[model samples]
Target: MYLFILLPVILYILIRKKSFKKVLRLHKVSPQQIFITMLLILAIQPMTALAARIMEHLLGHGFFPPMGDMSANGSGNLFMSLFIIAVTPAICEEVFMRGVVLDGYRHIPLWKTAIMNGVLFGLFHNNFMQLSYTSIVGIILTYVVVFTNSIYPAILMHFVMNALSVLMEKYPTSLYANFTIWYETNMVLLILLAIVSICATILLLIWLKRLSNNSAIESMDASDNSIEASDALNHTITFVEWPLMLATAISVIYSLMMVYAM
Candidate 1:
């Protein structure tokens, strides 16, 4: 249901733009920077598990996210987690949350819109444990959406993050098994992720500023009527067509099924 509902909508967005392109590359993230960005996220995972284990060990309480039924060896869980965590959410969420709503709210300041909507995205997860983690991630994702002014980077990052989780779970103990475990327990990766995110953000900001100076990121024309920025809502499919409403209905039903299944 989730897939059925979201596939068309994002496809519509992709089709909206005559062409699409990449924004940022984290892998090309120099070795020195990788260490900085990935260190904290990698380190904290084990501690989170260990802490939770210790708490349960002492108090007979193993607390987990109500919304997250993740485990090391759950059957068929890998693909499920991959799609749920990565692809579907990436497209649908980016479109609705960052693309549509945030864009609509451009009436507010951009930074303010990014922050406020990102917090809303986090809360949309509807879980206490996930609230903090997803909020952090939501903010990061929102910034990337804002940074690139495109959703592809967010989708790529989201897909990689989720697919990596599946890969690590399958091959749990290896020479670099630490990385896998780090993601399974998100906190481990978060420390390094935070540092890297911060640095990347600073770099990205500088890049955006440079682009602005050159009018590369958001180009302007000679005429005030022609603000050549994509941010300008020059075109929109606001006909209230049947497909749009049908898609919305399908999305609601799909959401209901997912919640029902959970």
Candidate 2:
């Protein structure tokens, strides 16, 4: 938690010349936009799970053991768990990944920016198991931040996702036993569920794109000509300089070592 805050602050001071407010996108979002983001996240959960499972099967290995196990440790304090697992990560990770790192790539195309942000966020975990799904979630969160022009939605979504993970861990058998059994017994149902979730996610993305377009139009009307002209051109993907490539390579190597060591 501390590193997340400190590292970003240090980087901002040393490298990023942009204002913290602009870099962090600490703007307000409408209640409706928050609701839509939440819905989109919920709709994509099943698909993400399926993707993770497929990745696990292809790799022939299970996920690395979690650093901490709340249930196993008998950490029955709900408030503490929520604070540590959900709130801290939502605030700290967003400040670093979506705030500082993302701002550094503002000159690039939005899609490229989002993908790079997601990849960096995934590698930041330093675990192969989390890299796949977390990257996907990161991409979605990046899109949300870009479209809404606010970090609050990304923070909220991250919190909700982490909270759900905590809850599922706490009540794994009780909460999902029936669904797990049904899924195992009925392949068709599992496939259908994945398909439906993916379709819903796609539709929500389309809706979000429309909302982003409207927001961009409003921003253009309110802003100066320089901003409008900057938005008009798509930037090339030359943002991956040597330093970034070296850091990413190191992260991947570290993650592989950790995975094998486990």
Candidate 3:
């Protein structure tokens, strides 16, 4: 996961952002939109998780094993693990998968490219049970990156979704056991979380719609500014320095291994 995910990301952000200002300008994302997206990540994650679970069962899998193993260590190690899983992936994966790979295919029909990118992302995961569920999540994220044209938005969304699952996993099994009890134990906490998750879903939907409109306006303005440049501008990454790519690959792999090695 580390080698596959991060090496290309560091290369893209450092190389692409510098070389391709037009790519950066393709999506107009305001500060307000970014904040709302961060909030929505906290809100919509549980719903997304539930959705993934349902898909697993529908696909004949009982439950999907998580990509991030929460209890791997750190009885109190939440902070460190959060860095590896949430912060690192938010940046690297977004840059590599969405920014580089998805945008690389911009010439294809936009929607098709987005969905295909999402499916590819899902398959990129090592976990077998998560393939179907993560694919759905990947599709949503792909649309997000395409519409906004910024990895920041995608990274923010990904962070929120991941942090929550880590928190849940780090919780004492004793505490969660109560919630897991079918008849009556920890239902209250789970119920409250469910409510919070639903609220997050609604807010996320609103935020996405708002972003959609703003993006449309920005695209129109851009098109008016240039009939030819819009078409002339390309999204592919070429001639990336090999050194940056190699360093990034080593850093990400070492970081993840050090964190998860426990």
C-alpha TM-score for every candidate: 0.54, 0.76, 0.60
Candidate 1 residue-wise lDDT, 1-262, digit = tens = 2465355545654766522232111113333333323443343344344444444446554344422455322445767666665566666665555554444443334454456655666556554444444555556666555544555555555566555555655566864567644553565454555455556655654453343332222321222344346744542232223333543555466667768877
Residue 253 alpha-carbon offset, candidate 3, angstroms:
11
TM-score, candidate number 1 = 0.54
What shift in Å separates residue 110 of candidate 3 from its native position after superposition? 2.4
**Rank by lDDT, descending?**
2, 3, 1
lDDT of 3 by residue, 1-262 (tens): 4565555444556765554444333355888767766666555545555555555657776563543454344344788878866777777666666665654454444455556666666655545566655666677676566555566688777887766567656663655433433312234554566578777655665566566654533543454445454454442222123323443454456556756865
- Backbone steric clashes in candidate 3, count: 2
How far residue 189's Cα lies from its native spot in candidate 3, in Å, is: 16
Task: Output the number of the lDDT-best candidate.
Answer: 2
Query: lDDT: which is higher, 1 or 2?
Result: 2
Residue 200 error, candidate 1, Å: 4.6
CA lDDT of 212 in candidate 2?
A: 63
lDDT tens digits, residue span 104-178, model 2: 666555666778889888878766787888888888888888788888989999999887766766676764645
Instruction: Output the lDDT of residue 176, model 2.
Output: 60
